[model samples]
Target: MIRRLIFAFISIAISITIASSIKAAETIRPNVLFIAMDDLNDWIGCMGGHPQTITPNLDRLAKSGVLFTNAHCAAPACNPSRISVFSGIAPNVSGVYANNQVLREVLPDVELLPKSFSKNGYRSTGSGKMLHYIIDAQSWDDYFPEPASEMPIPHTLYPDKRPVSLPRAGPWQYVETDWGALETTDQEFGGDFTVSQWVSEQLAQKHDNPFFLACGIYRPHEPWFVPAKYFEPFPLESILIPPGYKEDDLADLPPEGQRQGPNRYFAHIQKQGQWKHAIQSYLASIHFADAMLGRVLDALDNSEYADNTIVVLWSDHGWHLGEKQHWQKYTAWRVCTRIPLMIRVPKNCPGLPEGTSSGICNQPVNLVSLAPTLFDLCGLPPSKVHDGPSLTPLLKDVDGQWPHVSVTCLHNPGDYGLSDNRWRYIHYANGDEELYDIAADRYEWNNLAADPKYADKLAELRAKGPTSFASKPEPSIQSLNKLTWVTLGDDKAPPSRPDGSQFPVFFINQSEAPVKLYWVDRMGQPKFYEEIQPTKTARQATRPGAIWQITNLQDKPLGYFKVDDRSAQAIIPAH
Candidate 1:
């Protein structure tokens, strides 16, 4: 009886000790303040990307933390880049390579960054454009503006009349490409301003558990519409053209690069003499975003969680302002790949006893590592499923020995831009390549791939790239924008006005009967492409301004959809 009592006492003691230790660990786990900026390039005061750009809050954040000067996104578009960050999976592996690709449809079983935190005893909440305009509702415990809306963003003022400053050249022009200042105050303007206020309120209050708070600032993305006060510093006359722009930049490029450059949007902006005005508007938007960031920072500093929280700021991807002869993103270039990444850890964290030291580190890093890094810092159990390695070593010591290269996947599979410490190599599926010594030529004005001297270096980077690509999953037709339907008696099928690069267009037949698909030729003559049966979809290669007409098996006209610049689904609605 004495022996049995001793053993039972020991067992109870062991169980109590284990439970107490677990509780202690739960108490010290750091809260995460995650901030994301949309379409923001390296054009901040600390980065010196553009000399005229001003970002006081961004510079302040960099001064108190470790700034990653050579950080790049996993992908160059909004949806894929953000998906990579949250899921810790690269676009090549996830098969989500464009803005049109939905995250849930692509990787439904994946545990997102916020969801991971929530599972491990943290409250995950966010507001404003966190996941490609949708809230990714299931990942968070609570979200500002409510997750039921599916849009976390609050209302902001825009010009009552669209294309306020830049006139649309044609139907091919993106409507959101325009820019101007709105006559309103930050409070009155709302939008991101409202997002910051809600996030700030959360920071000021006490919570039951450690929180993972995300604040997404959506500006510098498009339309450039902010309060007029933000635009005062950047006058149109003082605006200089992008320093990376060169008149003959495309001359040394391969045929694929040549075709991708010189897009219609840039041509139209230059033709309309709105290049300087556009630059001015972009600068203003950056400044506005910075001010909003300041509000959130101030709230944190005044709160009780200031010294215990881990702060990380990042952009989804970089933007291109006529760089490499390209106007926007979606190009395999440094300007579109590199982004701003910063992390500030308070003293006595689990991963780093001393916390992060303030300095800039030039080592190449990708945003895909964010999830793993946060898990390490918070003392959460390590997950083997993440594609990216933990960044804890770099966080502990900025100059720690590291052997990793950043990879930025393009819109198509097997096409990627890889960056090491000194060189950038772009590999396309067509077997074409671009090599640039980015250390010397930051602008990437010279293409060194054709030179025999750099052949060995090109091969080295190519070997490090992704060997296999996941087949891109197709988005459901119900998720796409419905094209306007016109019956036979209503209107005639428009002529095909094909222009620009070609992309796939999906025709979804929702009618009860089978429909015949035809491509209207330039002269308005219908040419049969294929037949799409009911409840079926057919993919066709088409270009901007192209027209596709639908008809019954009896050859009666039904409706037609004019193809835009991007890949979209056209619904053949039932009569």
Candidate 2:
């Protein structure tokens, strides 16, 4: 009887210990809501970019949290830029060289930010352009209601009528009047409504587990679409043009460095005949994005998860408005690379004091820090492969020392890199170089590359860049008339075929001659055998691999490729 009594007492003690452990886990882990905007610059009301550009929702968010003023992107383009943030690796290290590369190919084993939360027992979900082209379905437990949109209709329905070509002049480009109205919306003629509505529903639903929700807004991107109401606020007459450019601004720069293309920023502004209209459109889109943000924030405030959730709002990269004669990203200029980053931690956390007002962190931070920071904020283990340190310390104290700098890579893959908070350096594949003191010349009006005194500083930065994986291996020409290739110039191929097999094939062809071909996999990489010659078939293999097979081919690609055989596909040119 004594033994039985002792066993009962031991079992009761074990139960109590187990319960305490579970409670500890629940209390330590905080939920997260990550909000990412597309092509947004430091134009918010809090940032003081413009007087009429009202971002009340984001302004209030800044009041409640910490803002990073000098944040920049690893790559200014969409695919590589977003991949760097999600993978916590720089574009060079990840091998995501450009917009055409698939992130799964570059960092196949790396656990994404959302995937980390899902693994830690949180209900991970996302909507809209959170992960570039499509939100990796595997990263989230729930991908539904479909990604949110800023327009009412599909993007494919709207096409720019202008001839397709690179622009020649700096900071000018033409935009069609109908370009902004091609998409459909939920309410107020914008698609942000759908994302807001979806987030509201998730907030209302009672869940037993903590949640990680990522909301991505597509507005303020190209085509600058918004409702008529938003346009009303920024009339053409009231819109202020950015500082004017001088003819000799970039005179000392090389011909290669000078702007080249008909559709470049200067051409757009000149052809449009109204630079103010273009600026107005961009501002209107920003305002609409802000309003949508307000809806999501309101939902969070009223929801049961309010006090427990951590909010992070960031942009993929900044946009240029006639600065340095550039309209889009892909440059290292402050107008093109610097983005708006805000973080709102719940009051329960031991970071900043409650209701913090307009705190600005001047340290240079990059999107690469987002993955590790999110993990740290949620009390998760730091990712072993991340290149960025968590900004949690800086958030608590605005004046904290975050001595690190950000780097952005432009054309020529690894060539033409820029390090933040210092001079901008551009190195060509041909060994030519250009340098600028960003602090002294915000507009990049002067070139200091030829200055012998600064040559050592330029060399130091060049030494720090990634040399091993600078460029991927070019694709191989195959016999089966099929081509094998890799994106971002890498030789690595996808692990599995479309049919879930180990074998895969890639194909590419000249645009002048159209031909159909069958590809086969051999020794992991695609080896092509001629299935049909160019004489008979009208359809041509536009790219060397399956992944490239799906991308729109008329535009320039980063030379990555893959193969798909689940179904026979045709490569058609854009009309």
Candidate 3:
């Protein structure tokens, strides 16, 4: 009896130890919900970027967590900014200055953000336009659609008569600058709505692994095509001009800032008398994006993992609407580089009981620190490659004196803006400079760099820029077949393929630069093949359904090549 009692006690102790270990592991492995937005600046309701913007969802989200009002992206373009966020490498070192360069082509073996989470046993899944393109499959465990497509929504919803490509009133803006409501249901509008729905379903369902759920909302970008009902909230007359606009803002600007400004796009909009209408479209798209955010937030609220998930929301870059007389996001101004960044750590989380506040963090931070911050939060091994400082300290204390200043770039060769808490100093490649003290000159109307009083501050900020930039590598072209055009919604290709297949389609990239090829297979589906080096002949068995799309990395079409039964190797014109 004594021996049996001793055995029973040992068994009980072992079971208790096992249960405790399991509970501890579960508590430490918190899930992450990463929300990404495209071309969305501080125009949300909370940031007061626009006077009449409606963004209750984003506002509520900020209240639920810590909001960083002074965050900036490393680069002002989508591709480079996002790459910097994921890779923890700045654009100056990576040399991915443009949207055309493939991330894999630029940094072959760099550790991506999602891959880091995945390494720590987190299941990373995403939907919609997370990256500039949908080609990096190994980074995420699963995507909404296949690995190659941007989103699951088909590319047939664009209005047939939309004057997007209509003879431009001026040569200032591209065809993508036009905007109007599609007059369709949210489901019919597709893209972001579908992406949100899929993400919501995933959140509600149970997963075997701790998840990193990413939802990318692509709107308020360009070709702002939300439903007409969204437009109803913001009538053209109700739309207000940008609040910080100054008529002569560019007068005191440096030559670089001057050249980037006064773009003909805003001038063209005024010339065509569509300034208010364009603003209305932008507001409507922002509202629609907020609705999508609401859907995801609601799903999370009702989800079982609500108490354990860390939610983070950010935009890739900001947009310009007559601010500095600019329209796109290629410039280095605050209107282009300043992005919305918010973080909500769950209650009873490890190292943080009830976590940090729903308060504002005013310290200047860069999006490049996102990866390193996430690693620290999850207790994962930190990376040594990140250039930006982690905000873990500021999250705990909102008013902590942060010594970091954000570095934002425009193009190559050190054309950048170094923004601290009180000042924004811009340096051009041609040795021109522009400085704005944000505390005194909130609108950046006055340039203070040339003033001798601020010379010490000017020299301090100028010393922070990268001493050298990595030279751009070999150029590659993007393919331009129906598959590629489908993602872009380019209506250049015909609705159907030509008759008579059973021919050989020969491809030769005439230019010295490498190119990409996109083609329809025997199964009649769109597929992408990227970074095909130049001087190689790829032959396709041309049947009745065979079609090809070919283009360089810079989006210059090499030529139009087709195959038919009458020819063995057909090379079409490069029109």
In terms of lDDT, the best-performing candidate is 1
Report the CA-based lDDT of candidate 1 relative to the real structure. 0.89
State candidate 3's TM-score.
0.82
- C-alpha displacement of 209 in model 1, angstroms? 0.1
Greater-TM-score candidate between 1 and 2: 1
Report the Cα lDDT for candidate 2.
0.65
Model 2 reaches what TM-score against the true structure? Answer: 0.73
User: In TM-score terms, which candidate is top?
Assistant: 1
Q: Taking the tens digit of each residue's C-alpha lDDT, what string does model 1 give over 1-575?
A: 99999999999999999998976754588889999999999999999899999899999999999999999999999999999999989898899998887888889888998999999999999988889988978999989778988987899888888878789776577879999988999999999999999999999898999999999999888978999999999988899998888888988999888876778778888888989999999999999999999999999999999999999999998888887667888887889999999999987678766788898888899999998999889888887767888888988778888899999999899889999889999989999999999889998999999999998999999999889998898777666666566566667797988876787878989889999999999999999989999999998888888888899998788889988767788888997
TM-score of each: 0.90, 0.73, 0.82
- Point out the worst 10-residue segment of candidate 2 by lDDT: 164-173
Better of 1 and 3 by lDDT: 1
**Candidate 3: misplaced stretches above 4 Å?**
1-26, 150-156, 164-172, 348-354, 478-575
Q: Candidate 3, residues 1-575: lDDT per residue as tens digits?
A: 99999999999999999999976865566789999999998999899899889999999999988999889999998888999988988888888787656788888899888899999899999887778865378788888778666433334257787575223642123557888878799988888888899899999998998898888888877888788899998978777898877777888887777888987678878777888888888899899999999999999999998888989999998888888988778888888888999998875555454466879987789998988888877777878888777778887888987988898876665788778888888888889999888888876788888899999988998887667887765333332222112222343322225453254445554456677666645454435655555566566555543456566676544433333333333333233
User: lDDT for model 3, on a 0 to 1 scale?
Assistant: 0.78
Off by over 4 Å in 2: 1-27, 146-190, 244-248, 259-265, 347-358, 420-423, 452-468, 473-575
